[model samples]
Target: MATLESFLKDAAQGDLVPWSSQVLAAQRFDLSLATVEGTILYLDLLPARYQRNRNMISIKQQRRLFNSHAVVIGCGGLGGYVLEQLARLGVGRITAVDPDTFEEHNLNRQLLSSPRLLGHAKVEVAASRITDINPAVTVVPVLAAFGEDNGVEIVAGADVVVDAVDNVPARFALANICGAAGIPLVHGAIAGWYGHVATQYPGDTTLQKIYSRFKNGKGVESELGNPSFTPGVAASFQVAEACKVLIEEGDALRHRKLHLNLLDMEVVDVPF
Candidate 1:
């Protein structure tokens, strides 16, 4: 019986494995495509989809991403973009958590929302989109809100979590759960032409310090009424931070916030 790793190593073309070879290997071994892709990474062969990620992401980091599990706590504005980037960037497993169905209002800033998808559940749509983008990535669409009832179980084994929920209380709930679970949380928020990205590690009180004044409100997004570009900008930063955590590389946004004013095309560092 030929082993999966041996097959992938033999099928590689100078440190890169084409997608066709990956597909053939999966079929030959009776394995899921994701399993085959993981084996390719384990053997230090870059998948064709991630060929461009080379020189920035090394073979070791790509393998780490293939084996990583990430949880995105909201599938609305920020989360939709976060999920999109994570899958494209080759995170192997993702858990998308969002309970709401898309509505007309979401069309303004939500990446996965469309006139055709109105009233469709966000997580399901997200899962389908992720699959369409990267079949090697497994998406677990949880059609439930992130709260005490399911937060711990939802984030179990995650290398990192992204905060894309709309409300301040929900953000705190997610932060608390991640703190208890020893998982890092990449926090992102958007308000009109503004957005911010920060990272919170377990035992850190950064999120508490940031949202303490908001109380029960969902932040200034209600007043600002986010523009279409804000979530994309914020999610870009969030995804980069999340990737840093997963790869255990780079200067992650821990204890500091990267604030953006797209209205003026300016970036400001807000340190905590």
Candidate 2:
């Protein structure tokens, strides 16, 4: 394997190349694509992989994202898209927890679910997808339920936790775990044309306060099955929130929820 410094010198181009090209160069050098990317970044040269992310986030923030660890519980609707975006954004490592398999019903919105992947474990599919999206991203797929017993351990050492679970009870459990761990949790839920996104930090009771009425009951998603767009939109919001927290930029949805109604084309930021 060639050293990263020499590889960068050999592959130096006057113009930026796409991520796929970077991957090919890394393969030729028998090096991880991330190593090439980091070397290029160290030289203050922008790889085409994250060129678009430059205007929104500084190079330092981009480096921060590459060094952050994010945990996503429940790899289904919202989880699928959240993982997709995080991988593209160059989040260094991700722990994806999902105990379910893809069903025929998941074809509607689950980004990683397809007829070919039906019945496959969600976490397994997530692993494959991120590998293709960005070889630099390390995805640890857990084939277990995130319950009270393992909730704390699941999110331990994480820089951020994402609540992509479908039920209110699981959300509460994850929220409590994150609060106790002092980790920020980005929450997103979709029910038909309506969805919500929130950023909850340690010592914040926003989650408990929001779900106080139905802590033990199923979420509205149970009654109103998700549409294709709802989960996609909500997951995008969740990824954006997580990125902001990781980069420590932008005002988070902290202690507040961004409600979306696609049918009416309106967004309301509700504060607790």
Candidate 3:
């Protein structure tokens, strides 16, 4: 087995680019006549060996994710982390929707915003950051509210949907869209030291059921009440589960919910 490091050292002796058939075949370690011809013509376009290894893992799995589309309904605390992770993992296309603009307070956890981005649209900031992270990723930014009017179209084109939005109405709307689309929706919510995440698919655990416990009470109003670390931890888990669902890898949190208590440093996975 040729190691990626050695192959990169050898390839570095020449020019290389990505996505060319030659680079694709060579990265796959296939030296057939077809691959040979492609390589001969575009050998200078091959991706560096490290990138090849990082990007091309089990051609079947890579193709599955590369052909999939994901929609993230919030580009705030959780959505920012989810978008960044998904882009890095090589998800083919991403649609980011958010109606808010970056503010000074967001600098605490929002990865896409900086001092310069204050007052700029969240989707624009996230789209630019996503492009910088992975130019190959196709990012669509929609600066609109995810409601009944746009929910169907927003969820229709996605293979998977992520609910990182802050409010209940938006989360419920996205969940409904995912259910209607028959796609899996990875859901996450944060408040103070507590946070929760779940994977809900049509005909499976719905966000309505998971959030039933809080319907009777008035939810937290001030975003300021949410501590900095809460969204980070919850968003990380949400992104992980979303990737698992996208890749069809290990078991996901479908039909189950995960609760985290940062104050006590505890986690519990409960069957829904």
Candidate 4:
């Protein structure tokens, strides 16, 4: 079994370039490809895998990100992109929960959804995709709806839970579960050209406080329809908030909502 240390010394790329495919495949030993990537990242070798992350994220911060756990509930437009960034950013472990299967309607915004994946489970697809992107990331795919029965256990060990679910009731349920578990929750949603993101810590009723007024059965997305660009924009902000929570960096969206309107090209911060 060729270890990352020996492989690095032997190849001695001396820069950020990744080792040849042959070296990676040969020295991988019993570890999964992701494990190999993780080992290189753990040593702060840069390995081309995370070279761009340098300067932007100190090696210390990268290490912190590599050790964090995030549970994302939903595998649609927002969840798919959130998971993609988390995996690429080397979030150590991710638990993705979603019961829905990919469908034609999701092709526009869901990164893991495609015509060939129409009937496949969304969480499973996300897990497979993450492994392909960054072998160092451990992704746990849970094919179940976020609800009262399994909500707590699903989010139990997570440092942060991302609320990418589309419906109002499901979002509230996830927030309650995360709050009770003392975990931070990053919430995001998009409808047409509009989107919003917020961060809620334990004991915060931000979601309930904001959505309680909307007695409507569902989110505005149903009527307005979610386009490809809206979720992409919103998910980027959601990932930023999640990373901030994970690495304890930057001012978070806690107790505040960032409203984005692509049509009007406006951004506003509203205190909750």
Candidate 5:
């Protein structure tokens, strides 16, 4: 390992060529270079491997993750991807609620779904996948659906709530609980090539209002008939929006909805 002072001294004295090889080799433990006519000759260059070893998120940001907790409802296509991103980002704690099982159709977009996990409960499968990605993340899987009865308690301790459910009733239930708790709710929905995302605070334009008009008297249904790449895109936005809320960053999607039409590659942000 080369010290910073020595490295700087070598650079200032025009000895960087010799120092570079020692620094790279000592730090990476894998490189060897020869010199020919005062020019460096490299027998091998593994940029990807070297980059991976050096890749790291800052400690300050990693500590921020330990201060937050998020709840994700429905471990399907959108929820699956959302969980994966959140866990990868090192969110301290996560509570995932769903009362369904992984099916063959879900493999297309559900991050945790696979042929091997075909009949497993969605929450269980998702939790297993999240733990594999980041053992540091505390994933609590609730093998029960989120309803008025359990919504309030489930969301009370969370700093942010992510709604990736497919049902209008469930969305309304989660929105009501989060609103009462004064927690920011990250909402995402997908239908075919179109998807919508919004960050709603208590008393702001509630999800119930939006779904009431859109669903009318009909029951909730999956628009994609079968899972596809659309939910992955939408869920990614939801995770990003949730993280922004958690970190208290400026200019969140608060009181606004982002609509995307993947077919035409158009996006529109509508304010409430």
Candidate 6:
């Protein structure tokens, strides 16, 4: 019986494991492609898709990513882009939660939103989209709002939670939920060309300070409106922070806020 590692080594093109090689290994060993992927990474071989993630992310860190799970609350604009990036980044497992279905208004900004998906549930679409983007990654779609009853359960066992909710109230609730679970939350919000990204570790009161000041149930987005570019930029930053949190490397955006104003051509990292 040949070891899985031996088969992977033989199939690999240099240090990179091609998708064909992963499929072959899974077929031979009667294992899942994810299992084969993990084996290759554990053996210090990089999957071809993640070859660009090398140098910056070592084989060990890539494997760490493969073992990590991130829960994204709200599969809307920020959540949509975040889920896409996380799946493509090989996060292994993702939980996408959202209560609403895709609306006509979503087409302007949401990556997953299309004319045919207008009436479809966001989380369901998110799950399908993630799987289509990365077959080896698992997508757990929860088609429900995040509230007191389901917040904790929604985020359970997640390595990190991303705040993509469009409202201030939901952000506060999500922060409390993450606090209770002791899971780090990568917070992101976008309105027009202005957006911000921050990290809230367990016991961090940053969300209170950030959201308490904004009453009226929602943030400035109600008036300004999110354009197509903001969510992509904001989600990109959020994924970067989440990746850092999962890999246990680099300085996370804790105790500080990364504020961006594309309209003004400025990106300021403000310490709180």
Quote the RMSD, in angstroms, for model 2. 2.1
Q: In candidate 6, which residue pairs clash?
A: none
Lowest summed lDDT window (length 10), candidate 2: 9-18
Candidate 5, 23-86: lDDT as tens digits: 4543443332211101221212211212222234333444455557899998997998899889
Segments of candidate 3 deviating more than 4 angstroms? 1-57, 213-218, 221-224
- Tens digit per residue, CA lDDT, model 2, 25-123: 677877787776776666666677788888998777777787789999988989999999999998988999999999999998888999999889999
Query: Cα lDDT of all candidates, in order?
Result: 0.90, 0.86, 0.75, 0.83, 0.72, 0.90
Ranking by lDDT: 6, 1, 2, 4, 3, 5
Model 2 misplacement above 4 A:
1-3, 14-30
Candidate 4 has its poorest 10 consecutive residues by lDDT at 17-26
Model 6 lDDT tens row, 1-272:
88898989988899998998898888989998888888988888888999888879888888999999999998999999999999998899899999999999999999999999999999999999988878888889998888878898889999999999877777888999899899999999888999999999999977778765675766678899899999999999999999999999899999989999999999998876
* Shift of residue 231 alpha carbon in model 6, Å: 0.5
TM-score of each: 0.96, 0.92, 0.79, 0.91, 0.76, 0.96
Q: List the residue pairs that clash in candidate 3.
A: 17-45, 17-46
For all predictions, the C-alpha RMSD in Å is 1.4, 2.1, 7.1, 2.2, 10.3, 1.3
TM-score between model 3 and native: 0.79
Error of 3 at 21 (Å): 11
Candidate 5 local lDDT, residue 89: 72
The lDDT of model 1 is: 0.90
